[model samples]
Target: MLHKWILAAFVSLLGTSSLLADETTQARCVVDDKRRQICLDHPAQRIATLSPGATELMFAAGGGDQVVAVVTFSDYPPEAQAIESLGSLTRLDMEKLISLQPDLVIAWVTGNPAEQMERLEALGLKVFYLEPRRFADVSSTLLRLAHLAGSDDVGQQVAQAFEEGINNLQQRYQNASPVRVFYQVWNDPIMSVNHEHLIHQVIELCGGDNVFADLPRMIPRLDTESILSANPEAILAGGMGEENQAWLDHWQQYPHLHATADQNLYFIPPSLIQRPTPRLLQGAERFCQALDEARAKRQ
Candidate 1:
């Protein structure tokens, strides 16, 4: 009877140990854009953003304090500028990145070098690829990043607000008259976006037709003659700085063009529009207002 009691107690202790181990090893899983399942034993405590957009997204996800490193020009949320630098998007300080000991790294699909990401992965670091092209993608990515950082509550609030803002824009512009628009990304080469670009989506969202939306490349380079031929009704350019109007002024020389003749020149800050994050709602709102002003001019 003494041996039987001892054996029963040993069995119960072993089961309790197994249960404790299982409880300590809980895992969270998320599927990335590349369609790979990434599982972590626990929420990531340290994160590194490899692009300006990624940095902004991290903040939007309510994981700003967890971000230990970022690339150049990550000036949004103001707090990001103080973070450690991993160099620019094209160049990275691998040594500094390793020293940071980030549990997770957010990489831009085409922005970050493939080889560098591979090296990080080989070193057993988890990498999450971000390339948000649509408004839904912008919000969903925030939620995903927040989930990884164990800040789902903040992430969900931000994501919901972004989606709601976009829906409001769509409803407000539902009956707006369409305007012909020309968006200049660069002044020298006269770069414009194709229909697949996010800017084109913003144009359509504002009830505007992008004259260069049918271009073959994602970002196509054109000549001044092309603009003269298209003669868009409104010209919107994101200049070098927040208030630089030189790009718009250059169009004043072409008085014969519809845009210049009617003075439908507007400026939207590049940072607000260029980076795919929660801030895009502001850019889209500005774009809709500009198109509305152009429509009023026609009357």
Candidate 2:
């Protein structure tokens, strides 16, 4: 009877040990922006980011130290520059990326080359895609990335802060008078965003109406005639570089235009508004302030 009891106790201990190991190695899964489920046997320890935006989001998700590889133009948070580069967003050095032995890769849905991503998957590498089209999407991305990186606590905090910042902006400008505005995305082709684009949402959040919001394409090439016909009250532009106001200067030739006439041509830094990250709150604040100034001019 004593021997039987001792054997039973040993079996019980073995079962408990197996259960604990299973808990530690439990699979984690998250659906990427592509709506495909990505499952990992355990939280990723090494991560590679394929785009500048992906790099920024990974850092925001508290996986900065785990970032083993990054592509060119990933120059945010200032520390990202120190990471090893695989090359530009359009072209990646696949051999170098494979040599890093990243357990997970953060890819851009529309920005990255699909063939390269496919090759990674074929080699048994896990890849997660991201494309944040809305403010809520950004928060969700933070949480998802953190889940994959085993930094859920930090992700939750940063996501909450970003959501609160955007909410504060929405409350501040919800009732302001609408300002007709034209946002110039590029000067060469004179590109403007439509309602489907994120920038247009920012314009609406600030109680402003986008002059080209009705355009068919997300980024529509425009002519001087269409812009003059709209005659927007405010013109906001992000030039080739931060603080390069040369794009705004081109509008000076059209003195008859309301935006030029009222001196409502505002130059916004490209990175702030262009990248869909936590910093968008800063861009929203600047955009709202610009609209407020335009409103003040009416008085």
Candidate 3:
């Protein structure tokens, strides 16, 4: 009876998967090791990106025209400004989404909850979650999404350029002292990317030593005193918006930090820093250029 029960469960799972699979097989797309489902057949011609990062990636993959709708915060590229606005990635406008009738929904793992994605899938919408974690993963994610969207050649071209840019940046800054960097993502409690995160990868690529590299947590909670103790050389305020500005005005409180004395504290464009997309290479290159300029001025 127990064996029969296990066999029945297996059959049920297979049946459910088959039922879902019958809904759509628009394309065959490579899924990365992270299990990001990419559709190879239909190619997401009428697409709705869930967040700014996904928007940036979609543009990079040459799917600008296929993008029928975007969420509220996808304001970087001028093209995105004209697209229909859904709600924020965290809180979607289902009604708006339904109206757009996107063949594929390029959703986010972090911003959009899993429940909403499941709901969309249950409604027979083809939603693929292409979330990536590290800098090395960005190129793959872009390429994979491009292939899924039927822009594989364009995606590969962009990925190659991005990779080449990173290589150039690393070579240029190969000899510099790894500037001790504290990249501020959130300000109220003083937070930074956890070690092993993609943003942290950007820091390393730009020849900076992450102060929190050894910390056990990815988004570890810490107090101001802890930040003071870390005493980073360069303070990068990746202001998500006005909220990150407090750090820019208040660093004077900790006069001992190397950044304060040398006036090395600065803000990189959040669009480039916050997202794990091709633009992050832009962020790395910008940081390297800034560090070079800072060095020249000091000399």
Candidate 2 C-alpha lDDT tens digits along 113-165: 99999999999999999888777778778877887887878877887788788
The residue ranges of model 3 lying beyond 4 angstroms of the native Cα positions read 1-26, 32-36, 240-246, 293-299
Worst 10 residues of 3 by lDDT: 1-10
**How many residue pairs clash (N, CA or C atoms closer than 3 angstroms) in each of the candidate models, in the order given?**
0, 0, 6
**lDDT of each residue in 1-299, candidate 1, tens digit only:** 11333234323422443335435674455556665556667778899999999999999998899999999989998999999999998799999999999998999987899999999999999999877777767766776787778787887788778878888999999888889999999988889888988888899999999999888998899999999999999999998877787899988999999999998999999888888998999999999999988998885
| TM-score-better candidate, 2 vs 3 | 2
* Alpha-carbon local distance difference test for all models: 0.84, 0.86, 0.73
Model 1 segments beyond 4 Å from truth?
1-26
lDDT per residue as tens, model 3, 2-105: 13432343234224443355367544445433354444355677999889888988888888889988888788688898999887787888888987888888
User: What TM-score against the true fold does each predicted structure earn?
Assistant: 0.88, 0.89, 0.83
Error of 1 at 281 (Å): 0.5
Sorted by lDDT (best first), the order is 2, 1, 3
Candidate 3, residue 291: lDDT:
63
In candidate 3, which residue pairs clash? Answer: 26-41, 26-42, 27-40, 27-41, 28-40, 28-41
